[model samples]
Target: MSDDNGLPGAQTRRALLAGAGAVGAAVVLAACGGDEDPAGPGSAAPTAPDGSGEPGAADVVVRAADVPVGGGVILASKGVVVTQPTAGVFKGFSPICTHQRCPVSAVDGGTINCTCHNSRFSIEDGSVRSGPATQPLPAKEIVVDGDRISLA
Candidate 1:
């Protein structure tokens, strides 16, 4: 016997069950494996804008002593590198490497180096100083407000 839809009752029930199972499988697959949330644990919080009117720039600070002439250091807590390639000049860039999204492991001799894939970036302008990184690190707008630096 067929129901109003013209399919046998058992056939209709089977079809419904198959459809439900397919949906369930899809849901499971979606939740199985993927990249971790960018803001999850071990990830730094987004930087606050330094009010410089530049989009995506975040407010951040670096101790005048933390940066030295012709040198730089990565601020792991803020996901940025503060540099002073020359006396009285300061530059900031995202510490997260552009190549593989890995946090820069160190900065030496005005170069920001990512240990993950051996990518290196310049502290002067955040340009790609080496490979396998092809893109420059993003620079953040920074303002020296008194003894503190505000990022924008």
Candidate 2:
């Protein structure tokens, strides 16, 4: 009654479905990867390198003043967290937690926090600060023009 996978009744519909479910779960976990947070601390998100080709007003996400130094402001509607690690320097990152894709709830104590699993990412670079998360938040590109911060 065993099939190639060596499970009893493996030719039955129930057995096939159970095997498919296990394969699907394994694929999901493999995509999530391991404990290494490849984006090391202080690895800044990419920014516009020059003043050319700036995003217009409609792309603007916030005013530079709104994101405080050493902290961040999460724009839920835009799905980004804009952080000012130091004066006049801002970085943008996805607000979605790298662990489980939950929206990060707050930016405080120098990290972007996800209340779901208590994961935290560095406000400066989106690197994991404390985790159940092993990945840094994916970087989001932004342009800073005078006081306007816009998506890029």
Each candidate: RMSD: 12.3, 14.1
Q: Candidate 2 has which clashing residue pairs, if any?
A: none
Local accuracy by lDDT, each model: 0.79, 0.87
Q: How high is each candidate's TM-score? A: 0.58, 0.63
- 1-152: candidate 1 lDDT, tens digit per residue: 44446745867788899999999999999888677774678875544555545433444466567677788877878766888888888888998999989999988867999999999898899999899999999997777655456565
Backbone clash tally (model 1) = 5
lDDT of 2: 0.87
**Superposition TM-score, candidate 1 onto the true structure:** 0.58
Which candidate leads in lDDT? 2
Off by over 4 Å in 2: 1-55
